[model samples]
Target: MESYTGKSIFQKVAVGRIFYYEKNENIVKRNRIEETEGEIKRFEAAKLVALGQLDRIYQKALKEVGEDNAAVFEVHKMMMEDEDYLESIHSMVREQKVNAEYAVAMTGDNFAKMFSQMDDEYMKARAADVKDISERLVSVLLGNGTDMGALKEPVILVADDLAPSETVQLDKSKILAFVTRYGSSNSHTAILARTMNIPAVIGVDISKEWNGKMAAVDGYTGTVYIEPDFDCMERMKNRIAEDEKKRQLMQELKGKETVTKAGRKIHLYANIGNVADTVSALQNDAEGIGLFRSEFLYLEAKDFPSEEEQFQAYKTVAESMGGKKVIIRTLDIGADKQVDYFNLDKEDNPAMGYRAIRICLSQPEIFRTQLRAILRASSFGNISIMFPMIISVKEVREAKRILEEVKEELKEKEVPYQDVETGIMIETPAAVFESGELAKEVDFFSIGTNDLTQYTLAIDRQNPKLDHIYDPHHPAVLKAIKMVVDNAHEHGAWVGICGELGADLTLTKTFVEMGLDELSVSPSFVLPVRNEICNL
Candidate 1:
């Protein structure tokens, strides 16, 4: 028996035969071409083919992983159509007088290197994306179709790495789990695995010699056992049964109040990125919609989302909730979430730079448009508006002033709308310190622990090198959250945590003791958290 350890993406157990996946290599050789125009035509034709393939993958991913995760393919399609990328490939093919595959391979390497050298970890990950698209183009040019072939039986897939395009194309039903030699928690493959609810382990040294061998994957411990002994197999079987029992128990928790043993009730809400996610929220029995990320509308758009488009999205989510409170954070763009149409200037430090409420406040017209849309949709169901990255009471006042202006405009236009409860995200130390004054200006406070931790610790959460020290559970962060909750309550403003830490069951008791009014997490976590709170 051989055992290996790695990082886990999801917690589950599986026993299956190992399937070593080896992708067909697209080795390009440079050859002098007589007709540069012909090579350019060939490159364009391959681009079209690659784009078509990306569309099909995007549709498949959309159905399997929902819109937000599916957007990765859409980004790939956009990258394929990027004018600069296309220009580089075309110029190289024409000037270098090389085969289309060669030009594409060279251009891909150059572009990918640029992205890899970027300071932002999110941008750095794009290196893999460029390579994925480049490889696809090269394969298409060589008349080599990119397919993983069929699996006759389910198995634990082991690969060196998986590109997002490749991950989405795999047959989900046949994949018991993923055991990759190389991948990060932030990799799109990891994201897709979580979305598909497949257990995955990365950074393991896997061997093709183990192919077709019996294996047990303990995703909870990030352990892989090959040719496992009888004892190990028995333990794995028991663990799998326990996991199944826990899932069934979670389903029985639906419609149960998230209250502690002492009778303290916590409003368990779900954080969602779009209207489509409301289905998951309801299926998981979320009492309300908290942290409705409104920026996806802008991020997914070709240009600025018009008022009507924004209105329809918000309205759909609000109506879908069927009067459950939906708190929409308005246009938290910039800082990792970039839109080409916004034309935001390059920044040395984007995370703390012109982002979220700063962008909305600086560009009040854009803020006003979103406000109008939210107000227009407020009448559809229970809806509220929250401004993000606010650090001062003055910013909150300015935002509310604009909100009033938008309300007046609607009244003048004789448009029907409803008043929305206003709130601000407590994400920075400045906001925590000023929570008393800021809370007085808003109806509630949603603690965005992700940024609060980042700002309080003065650490870049996106930097993997700092991952060891980037503790969201740091004492300062906890104190900051407690302070915000206390200050908000003193000002008669309810407080809720809408960050990843909110879903940390270990802290559920602490949060309840802190007198938090609510905890909003991903839909999948709603029940587990409710169960914890109920037991507490």
Candidate 2:
């Protein structure tokens, strides 16, 4: 018998396949009708029906966000009214002389193809929306409803990416886990997965070939097992048991300070999006809110929110946290989050393009609006303003100048506000290299490991082919993080982390050893990570 016993410990596991929509498949029997170079009332009626259905769904989702965050819905409304898209659809129908049913189908099929060719994952996923929207219109033309009830139950959802609509409509209670073929770590689906505390693996191979077989999904390792034998099943079972036990033990550490076994105190913080998310953070007994992304403020508004409107939004969160630290990041929008109303142009590589501090510098008015709101709310509780994608000292000085201007304006107007601390996200390679110098100017530092890892490694996070090259555990990445923390501390500033890696179980000890001041992760991970820190 051949002996096959000597082997290294397993580095990673493959448990599933990612499924992407086959958008290239040609539509059959696409009936073409002769056109008369004019708008057809029948096609217009079908478009109206589709828009109306979208409106109903939008209103329902808006209520969950409240009046403050309802601006995002307004953008969706505008998207439906995009004149170019409407014109294209009309041209296709009039020239092809097809019925409204076939017209909608062809348009959807064609749009999906166009979207898939884009470099952005967000735009690519938007292709699915095009397909879905057109299909619904076709259903209306056919005198039928798009029934999702036929969706198979108790099966893992596989897709190139999942949109907010698909995620919200899914029977959350029945989903075991979802795997996507493509998406950034901060993509909407990944954010929803963390918010929902569901196990999910993105940018992986997910297919139906393993139907009727148990596939062990390891969200932490980003792997899936297909048709595992008895031994593999037992090993995965043991791993699951261990994970559960760890979680149970971590629950006991809730509401307690994360003091290490060696008497080192580490702050545990929550990374939240909007005010609605603060409830979960507090429920988890977090020390404070470390990274409160302010992009949502700009995303949901019909227009630029008045300072007062922005103030109230910030005030709600401050009051909820009382005296706890709330590090609110300034508007971080740019290339990817294209708000056409703002006249922001789409870029080939938005991540590396003009965004964050760059946008704020160009449009001081927008930055001032957010800064004024944050400063006004500061009086209510602890609040800090953090600038993202900080690469130059000039941007820092300019941002500070704007804040000062806001303060002076508020003072002249006799508005009540508190003086606040300012900080920068040390995510770029340049920022890390200059931490020693930059630390002297900022109140503190928050290491955004996601971008830091990507930029430092010179890898596009969305590229699965280069996934092997993107390593947060590599010696170089670890050294960069340590350099930032050490330099920040040396300059008399504290440093915290607001990246996904901050929540990793294995890295907790490494961070503790490095003497990190705080860890801000998803609210659900607070208890477990704090527990790990406490027992360190």
Taking all chains together, each candidate's TM-score versus the true structure is: 0.75, 0.71
Worst 10 residues of 2 by lDDT: 1-10
Q: How badly does each model clash, as a count of residue pairs?
A: 1, 15
Q: Candidate 1 regions off by >4 Å?
A: 16-198, 206-215, 226-231
Q: Candidate 1, residues 1-536: lDDT per residue as tens digits?
A: 99999989888899999888774568899999989998888787667657756765675576578888988898898898899999998888788888999989999999999999999999999999999999989987775533444678988989887654455456777889999987666555675676456789988999989889999999999999999999999999999999889999999999888888988889999999878789989999999998999987986565789999999999999999999999999999987566657878646588889999999999999999999999999999999999999999889999999999999999999999988899999998999999989988999999999889889999876554576687888999999999998999999999999997898899998999999999999888899899999998
- Candidate 2 local lDDT, residue 381: 94
Task: Report the Cα lDDT for candidate 1.
Answer: 0.87
Give me candidate 2's TM-score against the actual structure: 0.71
Clashes of 1: 1
Overall local distance difference test of candidate 2:
0.73
Q: Which candidate has the highest TM-score of all?
A: 1
* Model 2 agreement with the true structure over 80-166: per-residue lDDT tens digits: 567766676777677767666676677677778999999999899878767766666665455343222334545555566665434
Query: How many steric overlaps does candidate 2 have?
Result: 15
